[model samples]
Target: MSSPDATPGASSAIGSALYQLATRAVRRLPRDLSLTSAATLATLDKTGPRRVTDLAAHEGVTQPAMTVLVRALEESGLVERRGDVSDKRVTLVCLTEDGASYVRARRQAGVEAFQRLIDQLTEDEVRALAAALPALRRLDTLDGQKREGTRP
Candidate 1:
């Protein structure tokens, strides 16, 4: 089985190989979208509208930086700023319809790109990847658990 916590210590060969593959695959994609922007869209999509301060904290950026990002996104028609219903004083950043579509399209493109790479692999290699899919999915949960201060 693959190790769960590569955040703190050295990763095994399996982890290294997986990381390399993922990095290579991502690097092969078009650079039209920034990772930060795509990730911000995904975060908003998952958690709903949030304050610029909250978003900055989530993204590990400064509030001013996030404001700049939000402004740029707004200008691009990817996201919009809105008054918080519960608190008029607080503004929230939300994904525009176009933003959601961009996130989905980018994600699909990534999957298709990776699938093309997979298609070139030998049958047994593909089977190995298939077998590892469950474990790979578990890493998402494990990372969440870690973020929540729980061991997985």
Candidate 2:
């Protein structure tokens, strides 16, 4: 069920606000890897191994670009390409233990940063944010569905 005010304009406004907040927050974080690299690592951490072409499509980059990124990651010992068990000819990119650690640390940093900001909010504002948590989680679920091509 949709909210009464869930019109196109409202959706656009929400998207813009969320995008601005996310980009600004991420920009403030200290990181060794580029945003795209971090994102690719996070994806691998979440979904396990995937094909290079799939990663490229998911990341909106060219196959060659993904190949280069994967190469760099491999050199850093962050990811490894292994043959797919079902099909030995296909190689799947899998995240390394170090890569998972990096992802966890980065996520923890982000959580801590948000926690500090959240602590400064008033009781009412905090309550409002808490109330919105379910909706925010649902948005994340929707994004996953879209990515898996399961959305109607």
**Could you say which candidate leads in TM-score?**
2
Model 1: worst 10 consecutive residues (lDDT sum): 1-10
Steric clash pairs (candidate 2): none
* Model 1 Cα lDDT, one tens digit per residue, 8-78: 54456667887898798778766876777777888888778999988887777899988988999999999
Task: Name model 2 segments beyond 4 Å from true.
Answer: 5-13
Q: What is the TM-score of each candidate against the true structure?
A: 0.82, 0.90
What lDDT is reached at residue 48 by model 2? 95
- CA displacement after TM-score superposition, residue 68 of candidate 1 (Å): 0.4
lDDT of 2 at 105: 92
Model 1 has an lDDT value of 0.83
Give all candidates' CA lDDT scores.
Answer: 0.83, 0.91
**Per-residue lDDT for 1-152 in model 2, tens only?**
56886785777797898999898789987778888899999999999999999999888889999999999999999999999999989999999999899899999989988899999999999999999899899999998888777873
Instruction: Show where candidate 1 strays beyond 4 Å.
Output: 1-11, 145-152
